[model samples]
Target: MRMIAAVMYEQGLPAPYAESSPLKIEEVELEGPGEGEVLVEVKSAGLCHSDLSQVAGLRKRTVPVVMGHEGAGIVREVGRGVTEFRAGDHVVMTVGSGCGHCSFCVNSRPVLCDTVAASRGKGVLTNGARKLRRNGQALFHHSGVSSFAQYAVTVPGTLVKIDPSVPLEIASMFGCAVVTGAGSVFNAAQVRPGQSVAVFGLGGVGLNSVMAAKIAGASTIIGIDLNESKLPLAAELGCTHALSALDPTLVEKVRDLTHGGVDFAFEISGSKAAMTTAIAVTRKGGEVVCVGLGASADLYQYAHTALVSEEKVFRGSLMGSCVPRRDLPLYLRYYQEGRMAVDRLMSGTMGFDQLNANLDLLDRGEVLRQVLLPNG
Candidate 1:
């Protein structure tokens, strides 16, 4: 098969992930599934900031890679020995593909699987060969699912099977933002019912946090973001309070609403100030989960006074602490039943050629959650 993908050569400099090399869509031959791998004709792929982060060199990963992880499509081909899925199954790609025997994979934290370098990164296929190439050069699949292209090859476990009734556009977002954002709260934070919660950023993850907070029965679900354009959507998603990211009264307002502080706070924006304020706005002994990918290590720092006295619990959650095959289908059901309002999170649909145009919105402080429909 011949497919076009957004390939990155170097990182840093462009907004929404600096592209050391501009992502150009070009035709490349795709590898057939060898063993336990399935080939999906990407129906819809969500363009995540992480993809931008990698291109911009913020998110740590290999380059000369095809960018995109969250995607949904139909299984057109299956590798030999694949028992669970057959061609024609509707599916969403997972970033985490475990060996199913490693301690991390066995412990239900496949997202943290230790063999990340060996598999599930911006490289060639798991079989150690190129799946796609352009002009006699190798083009790697970023995070194992270069869904930005028209087709992708991945392991069976790396895909979450979904029902055919759900629209591919909605299903695509579930592959990442929905699962990561919502899962971080309900699964990682284990948010208690009636607890106070605040989420920073109202993009895909932040909005998912709001929905998850509502599902978790949070009493005060506050959403903060610089874009006043996003608050209306945030409110529709069950955010009880929306604060301007620039408002100086933001922290105090959250504290007042929660009657002291929120019990759980999640920082989903890739902003240093948001991360610090998220930790600060939470009550004593509260938990703060960092869900966004900031520029670098220097982007994050904490004060001892805020931690020692309050007994604040800080954790870096990767992929919502998810076991994808377990969480993806679960969130899919939420969307299918109209309980999640996932359709509300979409910002706009852009054609594949407009990818950079869509990504540029992230740097300009626009775009809530955007997806690219190559099929469109």
Candidate 2:
């Protein structure tokens, strides 16, 4: 089948992406699902910072790849040996696909699965196949989910069946922002009642972290970001205090607000300076959960002695350290109960024509979560 899709042929295009046009929209060939794969008609996909990183050349990926990983759609067909999902089932696509036999998969850590890692590194589906083509030439898959197109063929391990009642646009965020942000609070940080929390970066992920901390009963939730526009929404989403990341006394203010420092700090901005602020605002014996992806070679500098003596833990969280099959439903339940309020995070929806311009908006920190209706 031929479908309209956004294809990236190069990386590190100069900014003003509206002009650089890193992603080219064109008609491409999509193959049917093979063994253990499923064909999905993508209803909605989200433009995430990770996508921006790939466009800006901060993250390297195989060229000529369909560029989207966060999406929700309906399963149109199931391939051989696939019994868990079938035609017409609503589902959300995730980046963490695992070979069921791997140690990480068996240990309930599919995000770290060895097979998925290798396949992602090579930009192919977990089964080691490329299902996208243009002019009879193969195109690489993005995180096993080339969802920037109207349809996608992906492995079952990367999809989770969801309630049809949920809006596909809202559900699209669960794949990346919600899962990674909320999962950090619920699973990685494990904030308990009365714990103090600080979130550095008030984008979709950081806002979700704020909501999750509120749900987890955190007494104080501090939202930090360089964009003052996001501060109001952070407050609306359960942040007790919203502060500028650029403040000269930001660390001191956070420490004073939390009566020393926060129990857990989440770094979601992918900025090295934000990571430093996250670490500085965490109390002794506290933990700093790093959820953002920065440049491949960027190294975070911190006080090693303080890390050892204070027992402050700096941990890396991928896809929220989530087991998609187990956590997606639970997070969806939170959404259903009206506790998550994810809809508020959406900036707006756009089509392929505005995709590049939207990237410029995201680069300028003018939006939170932008949904792409590929089928439209």
lDDT of candidates 1 onward, in order:
0.81, 0.94
What's the TM-score of each model vs. the native?
Answer: 0.95, 0.99
Candidate 2, clashing residue pairs? none
Best by lDDT: 2
Instruction: Return the clash pairs for model 1, or none.
Output: 12-56, 14-18, 17-56, 18-56
lDDT of 1 by residue, 66-94 (tens): 77888899999998899889889999886
lDDT of 2 by residue, 199-227 (tens): 99999998999999999999999999999
| Best prediction by TM-score | 2
Distance from true position, residue 237, model 2, in Å?
0.7
